[model samples]
Target: MAGAALAGLRIVVSAGPTYEDIDPVRFIGNRSSGKMGFAIAAAAARRGADVVLVAGPVALPTPDGVHRVDVRSAAQMHDAVFAQLPADIYIAAAAVADFTPRQVAPGKIKKRDGEDGLTLELVRTRDILAEVAVDPRRPRLLVGFAAETGDVETYARGKLAKKKLDLIAANRVGVEGSGFESDDNALAVYWNGGERALGPAPKTELAERLLDLVAERLRA
Candidate 1:
Protein backbone atom coordinates (compact mmCIF):
# COMPACT_ATOMS: atom_id res chain seq x y z
CA MET A 1 0.00 0.00 0.00
CA ALA A 2 2.90 2.35 0.63
CA GLY A 3 3.69 2.64 -3.06
CA ALA A 4 0.06 2.73 -4.22
CA ALA A 5 -1.21 5.56 -6.38
CA LEU A 6 -2.72 7.50 -3.45
CA ALA A 7 0.12 6.61 -1.13
CA GLY A 8 0.86 9.12 1.62
CA LEU A 9 -2.09 11.32 0.65
CA ARG A 10 -4.62 12.56 3.16
CA ILE A 11 -8.27 12.08 2.22
CA VAL A 12 -11.40 13.35 3.92
CA VAL A 13 -14.92 12.31 3.00
CA SER A 14 -18.53 12.99 4.03
CA ALA A 15 -21.26 10.41 3.59
CA GLY A 16 -24.93 9.55 4.37
CA PRO A 17 -28.00 11.70 4.96
CA THR A 18 -27.88 14.43 7.58
CA TYR A 19 -30.82 14.42 9.96
CA GLU A 20 -32.30 17.74 11.06
CA ASP A 21 -34.03 17.28 14.38
CA ILE A 22 -37.56 18.55 14.78
CA ASP A 23 -37.88 17.02 18.21
CA PRO A 24 -36.09 14.59 20.46
CA VAL A 25 -37.22 11.75 18.18
CA ARG A 26 -38.58 13.11 14.95
CA PHE A 27 -36.20 14.55 12.35
CA ILE A 28 -35.82 15.49 8.69
CA GLY A 29 -33.63 13.27 6.52
CA ASN A 30 -33.17 11.53 3.20
CA ARG A 31 -32.62 7.96 1.89
CA SER A 32 -28.85 7.97 1.61
CA SER A 33 -27.41 4.65 2.83
CA GLY A 34 -23.83 5.96 2.76
CA LYS A 35 -22.53 3.07 0.70
CA MET A 36 -20.89 5.29 -1.90
CA GLY A 37 -18.95 7.42 0.51
CA PHE A 38 -17.97 4.44 2.63
CA ALA A 39 -16.80 2.64 -0.45
CA ILE A 40 -14.71 5.64 -1.45
CA ALA A 41 -13.10 5.80 1.97
CA ALA A 42 -12.28 2.13 1.94
CA ALA A 43 -10.89 2.35 -1.55
CA ALA A 44 -8.68 5.30 -0.72
CA ALA A 45 -7.39 3.56 2.35
CA ARG A 46 -6.44 0.49 0.33
CA ARG A 47 -4.54 2.82 -1.98
CA GLY A 48 -2.50 3.99 1.06
CA ALA A 49 -3.99 7.38 1.83
CA ASP A 50 -4.91 8.17 5.41
CA VAL A 51 -8.70 8.44 5.32
CA VAL A 52 -11.05 10.22 7.68
CA LEU A 53 -14.76 9.77 7.04
CA VAL A 54 -17.28 12.24 8.53
CA ALA A 55 -20.51 10.35 8.47
CA GLY A 56 -24.15 11.10 9.17
CA PRO A 57 -26.49 8.80 11.08
CA VAL A 58 -26.38 5.45 9.29
CA ALA A 59 -26.17 1.82 10.34
CA LEU A 60 -23.28 0.85 8.09
CA PRO A 61 -20.18 -0.47 9.81
CA THR A 62 -17.00 1.57 9.61
CA PRO A 63 -14.84 0.41 6.75
CA ASP A 64 -11.76 -1.50 7.72
CA GLY A 65 -8.58 0.63 7.91
CA VAL A 66 -10.37 3.97 8.01
CA HIS A 67 -11.11 6.55 10.69
CA ARG A 68 -14.81 7.21 11.19
CA VAL A 69 -16.48 10.18 12.89
CA ASP A 70 -20.19 9.70 13.44
CA VAL A 71 -22.55 12.68 13.32
CA ARG A 72 -26.28 13.28 13.16
CA SER A 73 -27.40 16.65 11.81
CA ALA A 74 -26.06 18.57 8.83
CA ALA A 75 -24.48 21.15 11.12
CA GLN A 76 -22.63 18.49 13.08
CA MET A 77 -21.32 17.00 9.86
CA HIS A 78 -20.04 20.40 8.80
CA ASP A 79 -18.19 20.84 12.07
CA ALA A 80 -16.71 17.37 11.92
CA VAL A 81 -15.44 17.87 8.36
CA PHE A 82 -13.83 21.24 9.08
CA ALA A 83 -12.08 19.66 12.03
CA GLN A 84 -10.22 17.35 9.61
CA LEU A 85 -8.77 20.13 7.54
CA PRO A 86 -5.66 20.16 5.27
CA ALA A 87 -6.35 16.93 3.44
CA ASP A 88 -5.11 16.10 -0.06
CA ILE A 89 -8.66 15.42 -1.25
CA TYR A 90 -12.19 15.92 0.05
CA ILE A 91 -15.19 14.11 -1.36
CA ALA A 92 -18.63 15.35 -0.29
CA ALA A 93 -21.00 12.50 -1.08
CA ALA A 94 -23.55 13.08 1.63
CA ALA A 95 -27.08 14.06 0.80
CA VAL A 96 -27.34 16.78 3.42
CA ALA A 97 -30.62 18.54 4.17
CA ASP A 98 -30.81 22.09 2.93
CA PHE A 99 -32.91 23.33 5.85
CA THR A 100 -33.56 22.49 9.48
CA PRO A 101 -36.16 23.32 12.07
CA ARG A 102 -35.79 26.91 13.23
CA GLN A 103 -36.67 25.87 16.75
CA VAL A 104 -36.63 22.29 17.87
CA ALA A 105 -39.32 21.18 20.25
CA PRO A 106 -38.02 20.17 23.66
CA GLY A 107 -40.23 17.12 23.39
CA LYS A 108 -42.53 15.44 20.90
CA ILE A 109 -45.39 17.71 19.87
CA LYS A 110 -48.63 15.82 20.11
CA LYS A 111 -51.20 16.35 17.39
CA ARG A 112 -54.05 18.63 18.36
CA ASP A 113 -57.48 17.02 18.01
CA GLY A 114 -58.86 19.75 15.71
CA GLU A 115 -55.74 21.02 14.00
CA ASP A 116 -55.88 20.61 10.20
CA GLY A 117 -52.13 20.86 9.79
CA LEU A 118 -48.86 21.83 11.45
CA THR A 119 -46.33 24.39 10.36
CA LEU A 120 -42.73 24.22 11.46
CA GLU A 121 -40.43 27.07 10.65
CA LEU A 122 -37.23 26.03 8.95
CA VAL A 123 -33.88 27.67 8.17
CA ARG A 124 -30.93 26.92 5.92
CA THR A 125 -28.21 24.63 7.17
CA ARG A 126 -24.51 25.21 6.61
CA ASP A 127 -23.24 24.38 3.13
CA ILE A 128 -20.43 22.03 4.05
CA LEU A 129 -19.10 21.49 0.51
CA ALA A 130 -19.19 25.13 -0.39
CA GLU A 131 -17.58 26.02 2.92
CA VAL A 132 -14.61 23.78 2.11
CA ALA A 133 -14.55 25.25 -1.38
CA VAL A 134 -13.65 28.69 0.01
CA ASP A 135 -11.59 27.92 3.09
CA PRO A 136 -7.82 28.39 2.81
CA ARG A 137 -7.55 25.04 4.54
CA ARG A 138 -9.40 23.47 1.60
CA PRO A 139 -8.03 20.29 0.09
CA ARG A 140 -6.04 20.22 -3.12
CA LEU A 141 -8.73 18.11 -4.86
CA LEU A 142 -12.38 18.65 -3.95
CA VAL A 143 -15.15 16.39 -5.22
CA GLY A 144 -18.92 16.56 -4.95
CA PHE A 145 -22.01 14.59 -5.97
CA ALA A 146 -25.10 15.87 -7.75
CA ALA A 147 -28.22 13.73 -7.95
CA GLU A 148 -30.55 14.97 -10.64
CA THR A 149 -33.48 13.77 -12.73
CA GLY A 150 -32.82 15.66 -15.95
CA ASP A 151 -30.08 17.47 -17.81
CA VAL A 152 -27.56 15.74 -15.62
CA GLU A 153 -24.40 17.06 -17.25
CA THR A 154 -25.62 20.66 -17.35
CA TYR A 155 -26.63 20.68 -13.73
CA ALA A 156 -23.54 18.81 -12.56
CA ARG A 157 -21.19 21.18 -14.38
CA GLY A 158 -23.10 24.10 -12.88
CA LYS A 159 -22.50 22.73 -9.41
CA LEU A 160 -18.82 22.06 -10.24
CA ALA A 161 -18.26 25.71 -11.11
CA LYS A 162 -20.58 27.18 -8.50
CA LYS A 163 -19.21 25.12 -5.64
CA LYS A 164 -15.61 25.42 -6.90
CA LEU A 165 -15.16 21.67 -6.97
CA ASP A 166 -12.42 19.88 -8.88
CA LEU A 167 -14.85 17.08 -9.76
CA ILE A 168 -18.53 16.22 -9.52
CA ALA A 169 -20.12 12.79 -9.95
CA ALA A 170 -23.56 13.37 -11.45
CA ASN A 171 -26.12 10.60 -11.50
CA ARG A 172 -29.79 10.47 -12.39
CA VAL A 173 -32.00 9.20 -9.63
CA GLY A 174 -35.37 7.36 -9.96
CA VAL A 175 -33.92 5.01 -12.52
CA GLU A 176 -34.81 1.35 -12.27
CA GLY A 177 -31.96 0.19 -10.05
CA SER A 178 -29.56 3.05 -9.31
CA GLY A 179 -29.02 6.11 -7.13
CA PHE A 180 -29.87 6.81 -3.50
CA GLU A 181 -29.74 3.64 -1.40
CA SER A 182 -28.96 1.37 -4.34
CA ASP A 183 -25.84 -0.78 -4.25
CA ASP A 184 -25.31 -0.09 -7.95
CA ASN A 185 -24.87 3.31 -9.61
CA ALA A 186 -23.77 5.10 -12.76
CA LEU A 187 -21.81 8.32 -12.81
CA ALA A 188 -20.77 11.03 -15.23
CA VAL A 189 -17.80 12.59 -13.50
CA TYR A 190 -17.24 16.21 -14.50
CA TRP A 191 -14.20 18.41 -14.03
CA ASN A 192 -13.14 21.83 -15.26
CA GLY A 193 -11.72 20.84 -18.64
CA GLY A 194 -13.10 17.31 -19.15
CA GLU A 195 -15.49 14.60 -18.07
CA ARG A 196 -15.69 10.80 -17.87
CA ALA A 197 -18.59 8.38 -17.72
CA LEU A 198 -18.39 5.46 -15.35
CA GLY A 199 -21.05 3.07 -16.55
CA PRO A 200 -23.35 1.37 -14.07
CA ALA A 201 -21.35 -0.73 -11.65
CA PRO A 202 -21.37 -1.91 -8.07
CA LYS A 203 -20.61 0.81 -5.55
CA THR A 204 -17.28 -0.81 -4.71
CA GLU A 205 -16.03 -1.01 -8.28
CA LEU A 206 -17.28 2.47 -9.00
CA ALA A 207 -15.35 3.74 -6.06
CA GLU A 208 -12.19 2.14 -7.39
CA ARG A 209 -12.58 3.70 -10.83
CA LEU A 210 -13.44 7.10 -9.42
CA LEU A 211 -10.44 7.01 -7.15
CA ASP A 212 -8.29 6.00 -10.10
CA LEU A 213 -9.32 9.23 -11.81
CA VAL A 214 -8.56 11.23 -8.67
CA ALA A 215 -5.15 9.62 -8.40
CA GLU A 216 -4.45 10.53 -12.01
CA ARG A 217 -5.47 14.14 -11.46
CA LEU A 218 -3.35 14.42 -8.34
CA ARG A 219 -0.35 13.07 -10.16
CA ALA A 220 -0.85 15.61 -12.94
Candidate 2:
Protein backbone atom coordinates (compact mmCIF):
# COMPACT_ATOMS: atom_id res chain seq x y z
CA MET A 1 0.00 0.00 0.00
CA ALA A 2 2.94 2.32 0.55
CA GLY A 3 3.64 2.46 -3.19
CA ALA A 4 -0.05 2.60 -4.23
CA ALA A 5 -1.40 5.26 -6.55
CA LEU A 6 -4.08 6.51 -4.16
CA ALA A 7 -1.72 6.77 -1.19
CA GLY A 8 -2.54 9.64 1.15
CA LEU A 9 -5.77 10.57 -0.60
CA ARG A 10 -9.24 10.74 0.87
CA ILE A 11 -12.07 9.15 -1.09
CA VAL A 12 -15.78 8.95 -0.39
CA VAL A 13 -18.11 6.41 -1.96
CA SER A 14 -21.89 5.97 -1.82
CA ALA A 15 -23.40 2.53 -2.35
CA GLY A 16 -26.54 0.31 -2.33
CA PRO A 17 -30.20 1.09 -2.94
CA THR A 18 -31.95 3.68 -0.83
CA TYR A 19 -35.35 2.62 0.46
CA GLU A 20 -38.14 5.18 0.32
CA ASP A 21 -40.76 4.23 2.82
CA ILE A 22 -44.42 4.06 1.80
CA ASP A 23 -45.20 2.68 5.24
CA PRO A 24 -43.49 1.14 8.26
CA VAL A 25 -42.89 -2.10 6.43
CA ARG A 26 -43.17 -1.20 2.75
CA PHE A 27 -40.75 0.91 0.78
CA ILE A 28 -39.81 1.86 -2.76
CA GLY A 29 -36.30 0.89 -3.80
CA ASN A 30 -34.13 -0.41 -6.59
CA ARG A 31 -32.25 -3.70 -7.11
CA SER A 32 -28.80 -2.29 -6.46
CA SER A 33 -26.63 -4.78 -4.63
CA GLY A 34 -23.89 -2.22 -4.09
CA LYS A 35 -21.18 -4.58 -5.29
CA MET A 36 -19.53 -2.02 -7.60
CA GLY A 37 -19.39 0.79 -5.08
CA PHE A 38 -18.34 -1.44 -2.20
CA ALA A 39 -15.65 -2.93 -4.41
CA ILE A 40 -14.39 0.54 -5.21
CA ALA A 41 -14.24 1.44 -1.54
CA ALA A 42 -12.29 -1.70 -0.77
CA ALA A 43 -9.90 -1.05 -3.63
CA ALA A 44 -9.33 2.51 -2.61
CA ALA A 45 -8.71 1.45 0.96
CA ARG A 46 -6.18 -1.15 -0.24
CA ARG A 47 -4.46 1.57 -2.21
CA GLY A 48 -4.04 3.51 1.06
CA ALA A 49 -6.74 6.10 0.76
CA ASP A 50 -8.69 7.17 3.83
CA VAL A 51 -12.04 5.86 2.60
CA VAL A 52 -15.43 6.88 3.92
CA LEU A 53 -18.28 4.80 2.56
CA VAL A 54 -21.80 6.15 2.87
CA ALA A 55 -23.74 2.98 2.27
CA GLY A 56 -27.48 2.38 2.06
CA PRO A 57 -29.28 -0.85 2.95
CA VAL A 58 -27.05 -3.74 1.84
CA ALA A 59 -25.95 -6.88 3.63
CA LEU A 60 -22.29 -6.70 2.65
CA PRO A 61 -19.63 -6.64 5.34
CA THR A 62 -17.58 -3.52 5.87
CA PRO A 63 -14.30 -3.55 3.97
CA ASP A 64 -10.98 -3.44 5.81
CA GLY A 65 -9.55 -0.04 6.77
CA VAL A 66 -12.65 1.77 5.62
CA HIS A 67 -15.06 3.88 7.64
CA ARG A 68 -18.67 2.96 7.03
CA VAL A 69 -21.83 4.96 7.63
CA ASP A 70 -25.10 3.17 7.11
CA VAL A 71 -28.27 4.80 5.86
CA ARG A 72 -31.68 3.70 4.55
CA SER A 73 -33.29 6.46 2.51
CA ALA A 74 -32.21 8.90 -0.19
CA ALA A 75 -32.55 11.79 2.20
CA GLN A 76 -30.47 10.03 4.82
CA MET A 77 -27.83 9.13 2.25
CA HIS A 78 -27.77 12.75 1.16
CA ASP A 79 -27.20 13.93 4.73
CA ALA A 80 -24.46 11.43 5.44
CA VAL A 81 -22.43 12.24 2.34
CA PHE A 82 -22.60 16.01 2.73
CA ALA A 83 -21.77 15.75 6.41
CA GLN A 84 -18.51 14.01 5.48
CA LEU A 85 -17.62 16.88 3.11
CA PRO A 86 -14.41 17.61 1.19
CA ALA A 87 -12.94 14.42 -0.10
CA ASP A 88 -10.27 14.11 -2.76
CA ILE A 89 -12.78 12.10 -4.75
CA TYR A 90 -16.47 11.23 -4.55
CA ILE A 91 -17.93 8.11 -6.18
CA ALA A 92 -21.71 8.39 -6.47
CA ALA A 93 -22.76 4.79 -7.07
CA ALA A 94 -25.99 4.26 -5.17
CA ALA A 95 -29.14 3.40 -7.15
CA VAL A 96 -31.30 5.79 -5.19
CA ALA A 97 -35.03 5.88 -5.69
CA ASP A 98 -35.86 8.62 -8.19
CA PHE A 99 -39.27 9.11 -6.68
CA THR A 100 -41.14 8.16 -3.50
CA PRO A 101 -44.71 8.11 -2.37
CA ARG A 102 -45.91 11.70 -1.98
CA GLN A 103 -47.09 10.94 1.52
CA VAL A 104 -46.45 7.88 3.58
CA ALA A 105 -49.49 6.23 5.08
CA PRO A 106 -49.67 6.61 8.85
CA GLY A 107 -50.24 2.88 9.01
CA LYS A 108 -50.10 -0.04 6.62
CA ILE A 109 -52.22 0.66 3.56
CA LYS A 110 -54.92 -1.94 3.87
CA LYS A 111 -56.23 -3.57 0.75
CA ARG A 112 -59.86 -2.70 0.04
CA ASP A 113 -62.01 -5.78 -0.46
CA GLY A 114 -62.88 -6.31 -4.14
CA GLU A 115 -61.05 -3.19 -5.22
CA ASP A 116 -59.71 -3.57 -8.74
CA GLY A 117 -56.54 -1.54 -8.10
CA LEU A 118 -54.77 0.92 -5.87
CA THR A 119 -53.16 4.21 -6.82
CA LEU A 120 -49.93 5.70 -5.51
CA GLU A 121 -48.95 9.30 -5.96
CA LEU A 122 -45.22 9.87 -6.08
CA VAL A 123 -42.81 12.81 -6.03
CA ARG A 124 -39.23 13.07 -7.23
CA THR A 125 -36.55 12.72 -4.64
CA ARG A 126 -33.69 15.16 -4.55
CA ASP A 127 -30.92 14.33 -7.01
CA ILE A 128 -28.14 13.41 -4.59
CA LEU A 129 -25.37 13.52 -7.18
CA ALA A 130 -26.45 16.93 -8.43
CA GLU A 131 -26.83 18.27 -4.90
CA VAL A 132 -23.20 17.54 -4.11
CA ALA A 133 -21.99 19.86 -6.85
CA VAL A 134 -23.02 23.09 -5.18
CA ASP A 135 -21.08 22.50 -1.98
CA PRO A 136 -18.46 25.14 -1.32
CA ARG A 137 -16.27 22.31 -0.14
CA ARG A 138 -17.03 19.94 -3.00
CA PRO A 139 -14.64 17.09 -3.72
CA ARG A 140 -11.85 17.61 -6.21
CA LEU A 141 -13.03 14.71 -8.34
CA LEU A 142 -16.80 14.25 -8.50
CA VAL A 143 -17.79 11.02 -10.23
CA GLY A 144 -21.31 9.86 -11.02
CA PHE A 145 -22.82 6.58 -12.24
CA ALA A 146 -25.29 6.08 -15.06
CA ALA A 147 -27.26 2.88 -15.52
CA GLU A 148 -29.10 2.95 -18.81
CA THR A 149 -30.54 0.45 -21.25
CA GLY A 150 -29.76 2.39 -24.44
CA ASP A 151 -27.58 5.27 -25.61
CA VAL A 152 -25.25 4.55 -22.74
CA GLU A 153 -22.43 6.85 -23.73
CA THR A 154 -24.71 9.65 -24.82
CA TYR A 155 -26.67 9.67 -21.58
CA ALA A 156 -23.53 9.27 -19.48
CA ARG A 157 -21.73 12.11 -21.17
CA GLY A 158 -24.79 14.28 -20.84
CA LYS A 159 -24.92 13.59 -17.10
CA LEU A 160 -21.17 14.09 -16.78
CA ALA A 161 -21.60 17.61 -18.09
CA LYS A 162 -25.03 18.35 -16.70
CA LYS A 163 -24.04 17.47 -13.14
CA LYS A 164 -20.65 19.10 -13.65
CA LEU A 165 -19.02 15.78 -12.91
CA ASP A 166 -15.33 15.18 -13.46
CA LEU A 167 -16.02 11.57 -14.48
CA ILE A 168 -18.87 9.06 -14.81
CA ALA A 169 -19.05 5.30 -15.09
CA ALA A 170 -21.90 4.09 -17.25
CA ASN A 171 -23.35 0.61 -17.76
CA ARG A 172 -26.50 -0.89 -19.18
CA VAL A 173 -28.87 -2.59 -16.75
CA GLY A 174 -31.49 -5.34 -17.35
CA VAL A 175 -28.89 -7.35 -19.29
CA GLU A 176 -28.07 -10.91 -18.43
CA GLY A 177 -25.28 -11.64 -15.92
CA SER A 178 -24.40 -8.03 -15.20
CA GLY A 179 -25.39 -4.65 -13.84
CA PHE A 180 -27.43 -3.82 -10.72
CA GLU A 181 -27.05 -6.84 -8.47
CA SER A 182 -24.37 -8.84 -10.26
CA ASP A 183 -20.90 -9.42 -8.82
CA ASP A 184 -19.51 -9.34 -12.37
CA ASN A 185 -19.60 -5.97 -14.10
CA ALA A 186 -18.17 -3.60 -16.67
CA LEU A 187 -17.95 0.12 -17.11
CA ALA A 188 -17.28 2.73 -19.77
CA VAL A 189 -15.77 5.51 -17.71
CA TYR A 190 -16.00 8.97 -19.23
CA TRP A 191 -14.20 12.15 -18.26
CA ASN A 192 -13.48 15.38 -20.03
CA GLY A 193 -12.23 14.51 -23.53
CA GLY A 194 -11.57 10.85 -22.71
CA GLU A 195 -12.94 7.45 -21.77
CA ARG A 196 -11.88 3.91 -20.72
CA ALA A 197 -13.47 0.45 -20.41
CA LEU A 198 -12.77 -1.50 -17.23
CA GLY A 199 -14.34 -4.93 -17.06
CA PRO A 200 -16.47 -7.90 -17.78
CA ALA A 201 -14.61 -9.29 -14.77
CA PRO A 202 -15.33 -9.31 -11.05
CA LYS A 203 -16.54 -5.97 -9.72
CA THR A 204 -13.39 -5.79 -7.57
CA GLU A 205 -11.05 -5.92 -10.54
CA LEU A 206 -13.03 -3.31 -12.40
CA ALA A 207 -12.86 -1.01 -9.40
CA GLU A 208 -9.07 -1.29 -9.28
CA ARG A 209 -8.77 -0.47 -12.97
CA LEU A 210 -11.21 2.40 -12.59
CA LEU A 211 -9.31 3.82 -9.65
CA ASP A 212 -6.07 3.37 -11.55
CA LEU A 213 -7.58 5.66 -14.14
CA VAL A 214 -8.71 8.00 -11.40
CA ALA A 215 -5.17 8.11 -9.99
CA GLU A 216 -3.83 8.87 -13.45
CA ARG A 217 -6.28 11.70 -13.92
CA LEU A 218 -5.55 13.08 -10.48
CA ARG A 219 -1.87 13.21 -11.39
CA ALA A 220 -2.66 14.99 -14.66
**Best candidate, lDDT:** 1
lDDT of 1 by residue, 1-220 (tens): 2228788889998999999999998999998999999999999888888999999998999998899999999889999999999898999999999999999999998999999999999999989899999999989999999999999999999999999999999999989789998999999999989999996999999999999898777776
lDDT tens string, model 2, 60-142?
99999999999999889989998888888899989988898899999998889899888899999888889888778888889
**How many residue pairs in model 2 have overlapping backbones?**
0
lDDT of 1 at 182: 93
TM-score per candidate, in order? Answer: 0.97, 0.96
- Residue 98 accuracy (lDDT) in model 2: 89
The alpha-carbon lDDT assigned to residue 23 of candidate 1 equals 93
For candidate 1, report its TM-score: 0.97
lDDT (Cα, 0-100) at 199 in candidate 1: 69
